[model samples]
Target: MLSIIYYFVFNIFIGDYIKYSCIVPADASFQVYRDNFIFFVKVFYYFRYFLFCFIIVIRLFYVKNKFFRWLIKKICYFA
Candidate 1:
């Protein structure tokens, strides 16, 4: 159980925390400098939202904690 929790913490929580902390500010700065908003930055912005949605969906299926599983099932059922 401890290992499972650690796996989730590192893989999901910490990874996203780092990604959002770094990428989000960079994206915002680019937006402020509208002249610098290049194709790559636009792509990165859309990709970030896409990735966030993808992660949530992927976690619903792959995360193994029983409580999370039940919560996912309830969410899916309601949806």
Candidate 2:
């Protein structure tokens, strides 16, 4: 969870930088910028989902502690 928050915060800053650097001229419409932003957001969403599933599988199969298993269940309840 900490890593996910960090990853998103880092990407948000990077995305802002990219948008600032890639701004179009005053004569141009902002559709291209909008499309690029959407694309990046979708990519990030899919990547995060994949990472979450991978972590869940790893924890379920590899971790052996009864307390840890209970913690996972509690986490899932919140999720």
Which has the greatest lDDT?
2
lDDT per residue, candidate 1, 1-79, as tens digits?
8557656755676555545544444565566554343444455545656766767777777878888888888888999
All candidates: TM-score:
0.35, 0.43
RMSD of each: 9.6, 6.6
Which residue pairs in candidate 1 collide? Answer: none
lDDT computed for candidate 2? 0.67
Superposed model 1: Cα runs more than 4 Å off: 1-48
- Candidate 2 lDDT over 1-79, as tens digits, reads 8777757664676566555644544334776766677677667656756877876767685678878778777886898
Cα lDDT computed for each candidate against the true fold? 0.62, 0.67
Q: In candidate 2, how many clashes are counted?
A: 0
Query: In lDDT terms, how accurate is model 1?
Result: 0.62
